[model samples]
Target chain A: MRDAFHEDLDKISDSLVEMTRLVGSAMSRATTALLDSDLGLAEGVIENDVQIDAIRDDIDEMAVQLIAQQQPVATDLRIVVTALHMASSLERMGDLAEHVAKVARLRYPHKAVPPQANATIVEMAQIAERLVAQAGSIIAAKDVDGAEALHADDDEMDRLHRDMFVLLVDEGWEGGTESAIDVTLLARYFERFADHAVSVARQVAYLVTGEWEHKRRVGAPA
Target chain B: MRDAFHEDLDKISDSLVEMTRLVGSAMSRATTALLDSDLGLAEGVIENDVQIDAIRDDIDEMAVQLIAQQQPVATDLRIVVTALHMASSLERMGDLAEHVAKVARLRYPHKAVPPQANATIVEMAQIAERLVAQAGSIIAAKDVDGAEALHADDDEMDRLHRDMFVLLVDEGWEGGTESAIDVTLLARYFERFADHAVSVARQVAYLVTGEWEHKRRVGAPA
Candidate 1:
């Protein structure tokens, strides 16, 4: 019986890792769709997000069932709860990718991101893809060290985000208000994508370390 | 023992409703601070968010304990899990309110919304406050009809968001790119706030009705 429970636990981990892979692909494809104005690719990414949601729903359902039936305690319980949390973060990551795709679809042939900010947006998308892929490995291997290292990727994404803002708000900038709005929101989507990746890594860290890394500064208005 | 478990479940519901109230107040105060440039009020909202987080942490801890100890089944297990989901959504609502406060602080001594957009932003904030307060009653009473009514409020918010976009992008508008960026992001923050509120209402509807609402569109981007 205990073996069966452990097996179920392993399945949950597998499901989360699977979610990460799907999310990573979604981000990568969504970026391509945005850059190339490829409506078909953008539509595909949006369509696949449902698969990510289904996996999340499955993991959540399975975790809840395991808790009710197996009556896990201590670390076992923590693992199940953390899996649920990770599933949620992963699903949000997928949704962020969908949001990016939606922007691409909204702009169609015009391209949501302008040429001036294109390189930076591409880099941000690459970072988001890499970070989520790494997040998957961290969950699969339960590597606390790998989870901690995700912070660097998050920092890089943040740097790109800040640079994008600076560029858009520069005095000599010529992107017009509409393009500025698009780039600003697009940068935020990528930044938030990385944030969710870090959040998932933090959950993985907690699952392995049994101690939360940080309390997120309770009064932080932002 | 079963009766005790049921009582604990009631307590979880109460905690969620309490969280809703805190979030509602935070949004209201943050809006005032943004529109009025009231630094003290903004800071106060930021500070109070900690209380919301503590309540969420408590709900999470209690729900986990109940699941572990009682090993609840069927609807009992569903109720516990839904409470956790609701607590998470409410906590995120608080964080969104904090984000609004942070923006207000960042722009202190200067208004975040321009004179033209101020009234619309204020209206959005009011709708958010009303929706969340109604959400509190929905949770407390498990009022499915009230939860259903939240959709109209969310629709109003979406309409405002769309109109704000049009206003910002119109050729005659003169808010400048920086101000345009601020208003755009502010509008998005409020739109997302409403989205989260609707999500919470959907969760409540699920708890009472046991049917997920429309699966949120599987494809077509956005």
Candidate 2:
């Protein structure tokens, strides 16, 4: 029933949904790798990121082809354009996961996150995994309400990000500078992962609702 | 002399060049604020980022409008899409600079970079500034060679990043945990800034040469 142009768009959308799965899987396994110091799992996350990047390239190519052939104006054009931006955000999310896995890999034979920060790191990873999964749902259904709901989880992620610093700066902390550096970068990777997810959700909302919220929400860069 | 489509694209290109200036200035000032502990200078960089972000939004709008109106295909379409991506990278470079400023602000009345790491941070900032300035020139001229030259600076940035980590973990280091956290984050903000500059340069090369490099070169997250 779908025309060629719509069919191409559909394929692009499906590929995007697949990206969410790959990125989500990468982050979940990367987190486990971080917590357990699983070198194999960490290596897997880093190695598989090329797949995510490849999908992004394919989506960009498809979107450009659609634009050139169909010349769809107004809403159709906006969707394609917004999809390009979304693909970049998702690719960056994969990179963040790869970054987390690198930390795990770099610390092989030792836990990247110290015991004091263990519970917080676990919670951060859980929220990150959920956010990306929701991002996938938001894209599949084009659900603006679902996109808006991502805000609460992102807020929770930010809270955890701040709480992480509190633990790092606590006087009783004894993780040493190396573990502290690891935790600082690790927390940022998780926090940035959530930020990118929220960014993807916002782009979805923009297209679905046709309103661009240009408000900047980046509290602090890692 | 130029048709309306090329004229519109010329405007977008001009805006992109302007972005490089604003972003480069922000990073330069942010580094100063970080090293000198100048709260006022840091605040200025933080406030001026909105200007950088605004230009990116304007460029995106212009690019989208150009695509819709002109219906460009092939090389033309690719160029417009690449501009959109370059805009995002430049905007992120601004945010990274702002992140550096926030680190300085957070450590007000106390220095953010300990003396041991100060020289490397300064060198990193200098390279970040040069890369963005060159990014601007590359955009203005579409100089593929200039874009290619950015790799050397980025390689140096990476080497400094690795060097910073070595300093953090050294047994003789005495910057304390808080200072280490500050330096860790500050070092990462600088490193990511250069990465984005490299990313922007790569986009220019992609459009000019009609060749996209599928290589993955992210050394680490932080």
Point to the candidate with the largest DockQ.
2
> Tens digit of lDDT per residue, candidate 2, span A131-190?
989988988898876767887888999999999999998987778889999999999999
Shift of residue B39 alpha carbon in model 1, Å: 1.6
- How does model 2 score by TM-score? 0.94
Residue B129 in model 1: lDDT:
86
| Candidates, DockQ | 0.56, 0.62
True contacts kept of each: 0.55, 0.69
lDDT against the true structure, each candidate:
0.80, 0.84
Model 1: how far residue B157 lies from native, Å: 0.8
In order of appearance, the predictions have TM-scores of 0.94, 0.94
Position B22, candidate 2: lDDT: 94
Summing lDDT over every window of 10 consecutive residues in candidate 2 chain B, give the lowest-scoring window.
Answer: B213-222
Give the CA lDDT, 0 to 100, for residue B89 in model 2. 84
What TM-score quantifies how close candidate 1 is to the native fold? 0.94
